[model samples]
Target: MAQVKLSAAGERFFGTNVTPRSFEQWIAFLRLELKKTQRKRITASHNLHSIYLRHNNPDMAEFYARADDCFIDGMPVRRLFELFSSNAGFNHRFTLMDNLPQFLMAAQREKWRIYYLGSTEHVAQKSLERIRREYPNLDMHLHHGYIKDNAAVVDNINKHSPDILLLGMGMPLQERWLLENFEQLEFGWVVQAGATLDYFTGEQAKPPRWLSAAGLGWLYRLAHDPRRLARRYLFEPWWLIAPIYRHWRLQRQENGTPRT
Candidate 1:
């Protein structure tokens, strides 16, 4: 388990060590994993700033910390790391949109099959159409996110044995599902992609580059889905204050300086 040991700043911002890899590097790693001869699994996940800010939920924090590979999915988290973690080389934040095309291209070139699992049945179908329209050469499969039988899902996945599984079933749910079924699943790469399917299906519109760069994408999302995201953006993020201070104290101690 490679832990990102940049410093307490990295930990405080992410609740764990986030692998500070750029989009190209991340795709390269996935390509290498696809080429590997082993039948083992390769897991990758992304965490939003809300994950680190969720101080009240120890389980969530621990899950993020223990993910085999974690990337920054929220621009705010990346911006915060850039501001506070001077030693961290995390200048760019790569969302599902940034990585999906590259991944699909790699999968196409290598003739790797893909299984997309997420979104409603309708949205999943729409996404399938979109993928076919855009990436006509890409071989892919699909499963809706409204899963009722966990064992059945596992069995189905094992039966198909796709090279990569891109799961868009939100955060903690996807993480927990992978934790329970990963050992039995037969995918080379399992990527937790949150609402990527929604974006693909045009159910959720992509935020403008300016808004995303300014770290206001959450606010834009909140403006759209207030009922669902108000608490996450407005209240949950307040929990980050405690960890930010704690990180500062640790830095002071490491520098052998007295706290003023």
Candidate 2:
């Protein structure tokens, strides 16, 4: 199925399409589409500011562009849609944490075998325990993000052959890894879930809904892990302005308006 293109919003965010689908819509799409097409390869990449870094890295950016399904997982990117799209009413942000319960329920109902990759061994174990507590019948496997041997990792995934693969090893790396191994992965959906595993294990907590709604979730993350996220949360968002402006310029040019 073709991704419903988001209009008024630019066709591309940097180099990737700003394909905005709500949380409910995303679940529905997954259920319907995956049921219909078994060979369909779908990648769900979220947390928008990472796109700036992806933009700088051509390979990663191309993977984001090629994803069969893309959802806006960060607020700043939602705000950008509001700023740039005439039909912005449909855009909404849902983090990985916000999405997990419904997603797991659906996966359980659909009988999808899942593989969880990324995060430390402790976090991965704790996350699986929590998941099993909540979803007793969730057919899933876990592997810590520390594994460096790409071939071995691919071998393990192929051995199990999960219907869905959740890669939560954080941005660029997770996306890059997914793309690099895309050919070898015979799975339903490969999701790039940054810190979802940590959230599951209570190793990290998301900012309050208010902060996320106010587009300050990045700030909360920065406060919690300053040493790691400070540069990403502080500097990466600023990079979006250039692409947004470029989109605006293209829109104006298309409408027969003179450049300022």
Predicted model with the maximum TM-score: 2
* Best model per lDDT: 2
lDDT (CA) per prediction: 0.67, 0.73
The segments of candidate 2 whose C-alpha lies over 4 angstroms from its true place after superposition are 1-11, 38-40, 256-260
Q: How close is candidate 1 to the true structure, as a TM-score?
A: 0.82
**Per-residue accuracy of model 2 over 124-202 as CA lDDT, tens digit each:** 8887888889999888888999987978988998887887888888867887788778888777777777778787667
- The C-alpha local distance difference test score for the whole of candidate 1 amounts to 0.67
- Supply candidate 1's per-residue lDDT for 141: 83
Residues 1-260, candidate 1, lDDT per residue (tens digit)?
33322312233344555555666656666666678776545355434443553455554555655555566667766665665565556555677754576677767877888888887999889878877888888889888889998788788877878888888787667766776676788887777777887765668866776887677777778888889888778776677666666766766676732121
lDDT of 2: 0.73
- The parts of candidate 1 lying over 4 Å away from their true place are 1-15, 38-50, 84-88, 256-260
